[model samples]
Target chain A: MIASGYLISVIAAMGIVTFALRALPFVAARWLQRHALVQALGQFLPLAIMTLLLVHSATGAALAHAGWPWPELLAVALVVVLQWTRRNALLSIVLGTCLYVLMRNFLV
Target chain B: MNDSNDPAHGPQRLSVLSLSAPVAMGYVPLGIVFGFLFVQAGASWWLAVLASLLVYAGAAQYMMIPMLAAGLSVGTIALATLIVNSRHVFYGLSLLDALPRRRLLRWYIVFALTDETYSVLTTIAATTSDRQKLLVALLNHCWWVLGTLIGALIGAQAQVALAGLDFVLAALFAVLTVEQWRTKKSAAPLWFALGAYALAYGVAAKHALLLSIVLSLVAGMLWQAKSAASGEVQR
Candidate 1:
């Protein structure tokens, strides 16, 4: 089991970081609005960060197991396509994950 | 926007429920998955509930599972959380005026601002009362925590380990990335991110995520400068 003390600390740190990010614009609305760079980063960062997270996590998962990353690639692609077409997050995640679990258990 | 024929408290309560109902649909199952995966990662169940209660951001909470499993430093996880949640900074910009004025209510609403909550608040009738808005946030929050509790309990009961179940995290990120892509003005960020990740991986596989994020930040600034200069030239 993961150490509870360490886990608590991580949770606390994450909570602080998330709250700070959410609260920043409210606390500094004027400053944020005046800065063109802020707007630029705002427009530029979200998609990039999300894409990186997806790629990084998928790569991490792919590396953890042996053999080709077909399962990883297929599942992620299925999720992306489902999300893009249906616009339903829960459906995409559930179906993609279910497909992945099935592949890892039976197919491989 | 006519509320003239509407009854006072009942209809308002119904509307709040209706506004939050869709959010509940998404949060409950997603929260359950987060809690279950987190527990399956070997942390205690209550911590998952605590995360859902406190961190409240779905993607960051999901992202934390593997980091915690790998025993990443709090600093690294915190940095990752900051990067993952930075979009929330922009979320509050559009909500500055709409939030309740009372300090307690306003701050609570601010604290509870998930993507779904933000969308619901933004789309709700402008005439929505501050209290009803609070209810929407509160109800959504409850759904998330409740789902976490349920899933954690279920996870605790299940002893058989299933391979690849943790891939839910990737699927969640994929879904989020696709949504972000849909709203994107240009696909340059996607390509830029992939390129940065590839370079970062080559430089240091262990620190790839952090290095890539730093690279992406630098690239974002340069991209913005280039676009701004181009606009000037066009003028």
Candidate 2:
């Protein structure tokens, strides 16, 4: 009985967050789509958000230190190279991840 | 790169068909990490699989597993999920403009707003055929769903490591970073994040980091307008 209660709660909680995030955009976007300012923001938001996200995402492993995690930095450099040269998403992720794992274990 | 053939700022239609293969390629390994962590959190495969299928927010789902396993309240999990995924709100702001006004696509677009999908779909110049973009979005959702399901199912097959799995999100972000740098004409994201992080750290004192993301988005928009105006004046 207790376990089932927990299960129900988890599912319900998950449902709400998932549903809310999905629904908010539809409502917000429809109303905001025709606005000049909103459209302009949308245009530039991608570049800004992507940059913030990159910095946001890389908050793992190493920090604002230099030479401490040269391997990780080098792997990131490779990811940048792959992204720039080929624009291949999956390939860069795979290569960057593999390089990091190998470097973390072997080099470090 | 040609001015006449520029794909950016192009008129687009809802893309037909799904880009499942590409989406899958991106999601599988990443989802494996989510599954591995779910197991590490002491949750059974059933719980993790169901959440991955239904909830489907990669970062938060992973975060939820540990909290849920710890017997935390549903509200707690939900709140954490909201915080981790608050950025999704901003992601929707831009892409929603091009979204199909129809019923089904709207629902799917909202549901499929994963970071990877948003990054890929948003860059195809606004004018890319909407049919293609819709297909790409649908395919991207399938890839993530399938990846999560497969990863959770594979839980018992072998030992799964959670230690390094956290890095997948970072890696995915790195991929997005490269994407933005290559195609876009602006460096706003990089500068926004740095400036926002600094501002957030300075003013927040003890507030959530999410405030920074929101403020940064607003500041970024304002900064873009100012820069464009300056360029026009200089020209």
Candidate 3:
């Protein structure tokens, strides 16, 4: 039913993008594995990418705001402190999300 | 170094099978909801599978249903999907270090960049080899394909209720996070995430959250290297 030409086209575009990203290393790395430059870069790349992910998750995509999105910020802060103190990711996300809802409801 | 010869394949396959019980326990309801929502949005079962395969980003898939429900444009949908999944770009880069040196292992590593694979791979990294990494990637890929295809197929015809199962993914991530914290010492990644979130929010207005992820991952690596070097010197 949702078979419009545009929707199909969009899906194809997405497929191409996803394929390219996933396909690059699959094709390139097969031959280049032992290359020194490649090896040197490999060690720290994951940490870097992950850091960006955490920061984005923590701050939640709002650069240049006046007061900041207090609730989301608060939620991220709580998750970090709890995770740091207790090393608990589950509690961090659950409690953080709860805090997010509360902040959305009353904090702002 | 062929895929079939990967030593990591055993653990990777085991982990895939290992996670399945939980997913089967989890995906049916979630898949049904996705199915119902897709159907409600005028998409066929076939379309759901296409979306799942082409755009395997989970939350984006859920969000797409609503966007379609609202009759949004294809361009708008594409842009939204891109933004939502922008964080995923980092996953490949991370695999570069451990899996990059071996070209044979590298190709398979990139194909399996889903959240589940990341969790499983990160957990087994210290113990992993080229074969192991390939197995992990391939096995993880199988899990997503199975969960998604099964969900789409079953969800299309029936009204199975998986309301609270949304938390299953959170729960899975929680499991992985706890394991990581207990076994490893690099809490910086988490902190980096929080810090990045804060920074992106404070200055930039464009989905500070996404910016934080990219920035935090970049910065986190810098800090990790700095600390690793200092630690190496102290030793």
Candidate 4:
């Protein structure tokens, strides 16, 4: 088992970092609002960041299994399409995850 | 505040509950997965609960599990968390005026500004009361912690061998990505992200996410400059 002391320290550090990031804009709202670049990035970064996260996590999952990344690709595609058409977050996640688990368990 | 029977208060309370209900749906299951994986990876169940209660950022929490298991340094994990959650820095930009003005409520809202919370706060009517906004954040946090507690207990008891269960995180990211895409003003960021990831992966597979994030930041700056220059020309 991981040491509680070490784990607690890690948690504390992560919490501090996360809180700092989240509070940065609120603390610096005047400066952030004043800058055109900040506005541009505010428009630009969210989509980029979310897409990177999706790709990175999906890639990580694909690498965990051998051979083709077909399962990851298919499942992610289903999720994107389902979410796009239905606009239901829970449905898309549940169905996509269930399909991925099924393929990983039975097919390979 | 104590008047649940007051007709005016009832709908307002219901609206807050309705708003947070969807977030609960996502957070609970995702929190469960995080808890189960952390315990199954050898951390104590309560530590999983602690991480959920403390860290509260879903993606970073999920990413930390394998790193912690690998005995990576705390500094390394912190840097990775920063990269994974860098997007949050921008989340508050849009909510500067919308968030509560009081010290405690404001800070608590800031601390609880997960992707789901941010999206919900942004979509809710601007007339929403400060107390109601706090309720939404508080309720979402509670759902996440409750889910982690339940899952950690389950994980401590039995060892279920299941493959691809952790794919829930990726699925969650997919859902968030779709939502982001729907509200996108231009498609350039999407293309930029794809190219950046491909380039970063080719250069260093292990640091692809970090490198790609850096690349995208630089790209966003350059893209802004270009657009600004063209607007100057038009003017």
Candidate 5:
């Protein structure tokens, strides 16, 4: 195992880099705001990014095992349906997650 | 606006924090999961706290657990983090006009802008004061940091093997994506994203996320450009 001091330094490096990524745009806000491409990205990119994240998460789960990730797939479906019908994010996520945990423990 | 005379300093600051209550539902649980996972990866609770305080990006921090265990180089970790959180740059673009001109507050807001806060701020009425926006940002930041610290403490003590809890991250993203779909009323972005992901997965499952994100963005921009050109043609 790496030493604690080295680990702490790594975390600090991570923190610095993350802060830089976040702060760069605000520092150049004027140019970014006026850029047509950035404007278009601002409008449409969130949905795409969100969708990519969903797929990435699901695929990560699925690829970890040889068989299908039944619980994950089911939980995602349940979450989507719940959010669609109820229009409540917290309820859907919390419930879907609980269902996934239960399925992972018992159903599998 | 004037930095010294900020509205957040006004009497209504409490309400701004209250407005962020909805975010607690997601941040609290997710933070706990991250803390638990961090400890499970053999890191101390203090590391989890340090991460939450410093790297506060939820998904990126979650990804850090596996990367840390693998003993990857710092450069790899930093690059992966940049790719994952690069979406924040877009968030900054959307919030730029709404942000206060004061240097410190602006920097804080920019640093604090996560996916949930961005969603909340963007949907808030345009007339909402800068102080309220700052409050929302601050409250969410506090919720996440505190939640992580609490979770780390519990996790360090219990050492409970809570397998499958990591799925919370996936579930959170699923909910967010569904919410976006419902509001936007267009399936093109979703389709493009799915297509890119599938293709990238086929080509390289390990690097599929980064590849798919790049592919999806390219496809989205191309589609937008084509549609705009067609509109001009019709006009």
Candidate 6:
């Protein structure tokens, strides 16, 4: 375990970086608003970032174990199907999470 | 556009808390899981509360537990967090024109623009009063903080049978990705993400997420530039 002082500092550091990122465009509002590169990135980056996060979550178990994470894959598939058909975020997340918990404990 | 400001349709009639109530369904459970994991990783409840209060980025907070347990350096943790929450930069872009003019309120809106809040704000009509927008942002922020406090208190008091609960974070991300894909109906970003992840994983298994994010952003920009050039030639 790390020291308490270090942990607090780490948390503070994370907060500072996060707040800075959030404040970037607001701080540089004029330049960012006029910059074509920033605009193009602003449009495309959200989906790409979301997809990257999904991959991070999906591959966490598989990467850790050096094998395919069947349960996670299947649960994510279920989430996609549920969200697509039902069009409900809460339902899809809750049901998919429950399925993952059940599968990891028993099936996997 | 002007209906929201009419005396009959005043802010008092539309309680900001009600607008934020729907988010509780998502935030409460996830916050509890984060708190539970934080305590499970042998951290104090106060630390969990402080992190949630200050950082307030869900995925980064989740990643912090494992990183902390592994005794990583503070600088490394900070860098990892910056990468994980880098998406917020773009989110801030989308809200630039809509954010309030007052410096303090604008800064607060910037500080509280979480993924959920961004989605809500962007989907709402542009005519929404600045007051309503700020109210929604503040209310959602409170929900997350309150949920984290509750979870930390519970996790500190008793051990809960939450063996597989960490997967909630994964599920939440999966759902959000699906939602974004559905809205955009574009496969290019998804393909770029997969390609980046595969390549990064081959190079560095542990840091693949950070690497893949950087790779994907670069690849996305290149693709955008190429497409723009081609359009110029055609025109």
Q: Identify the candidate with maximal DockQ.
A: 1
Off-target runs (Cα >4 Å) in candidate 6 are A63-68, B1-13, B122-133, B160-162
In TM-score terms, candidate 2 sits at 0.65
Quick one: best TM-score, which candidate? 1
> Which candidate number maximizes lDDT?
1
The lDDT, on a scale of 0 to 1, for candidate 5 is: 0.78
Which model is ahead, 1 or 3, in terms of TM-score?
A: 1
Off by over 4 Å in 1: B1-6
Candidate 3 lDDT score at position A96: 63
Residues A20-89 of candidate 1 have per-residue lDDT tens digits of 9888988999999988788888888999999999999889888978999999999999998899889988
Give the C-alpha miss distance for residue B138 in model 3, angstroms: 2.9
All-Cα superposition RMSD per candidate: 2.8, 8.5, 8.7, 2.4, 4.4, 4.0
For residues A1-108, what per-residue lDDT tens digits would candidate 2 score against the true structure?
126567667867876787686577667766665555555565555555555555544543555224486755687788888878888877887788788777766566
The digit string of per-residue lDDT tens for model 2 on B1-235 reads 5533656433332222233455576677677767665655555666666666677776666556545666878776776566456557667767766777787876776777777777776766676666666777767666666666666667656665633444555666677666656656767656766777667657863332456668766775686578678868999
TM-score of each: 0.95, 0.65, 0.49, 0.90, 0.81, 0.85
Q: Give the better candidate number (1 or 4) by TM-score.
A: 1
| Better structure of 4 and 6 per lDDT | 4
At residue A41, give the lDDT of candidate 1. 88
Worst 10 residues of 6 chain A by lDDT: A59-68
What is the lDDT, from 0 to 100, of the residue A51 in candidate 6? 79
* lDDT for model 2: 0.64
Q: Encode model 3's per-residue lDDT on A1-108: one tens digit a residue.
A: 566675677677665565565555545655445444333233333343334433433332232223566654565566656776776444565676566555544544
TM-score of chain A of each: 0.92, 0.62, 0.52, 0.85, 0.70, 0.78
The fraction of reference A/B contacts recovered in model 1 reads: 0.88
Q: What is the per-residue lDDT of model 4 for residues A1-108, given as tens digits with 9 covering 90 to 100?
A: 888888888999999999999999988878877787877776787789888988998998889988899999999999999999999888998999999999999886
Runs in model 3 with CA error above 4 Å? A19-108, B1-32, B100-105, B159-235
Off by over 4 Å in 4: B125-127
Q: Taking the true A–B contacts (Cα pairs closer than 8 Å), what share appears in each candidate?
A: 0.88, 0.45, 0.20, 0.81, 0.64, 0.72
After aligning candidate 5 to the native by TM-score, how far in Å is the CA of B58 from where it should be? 2.2
**Residue-pair clashes per candidate, as listed?**
0, 16, 42, 0, 0, 0
Better candidate by TM-score, 1 or 5: 1
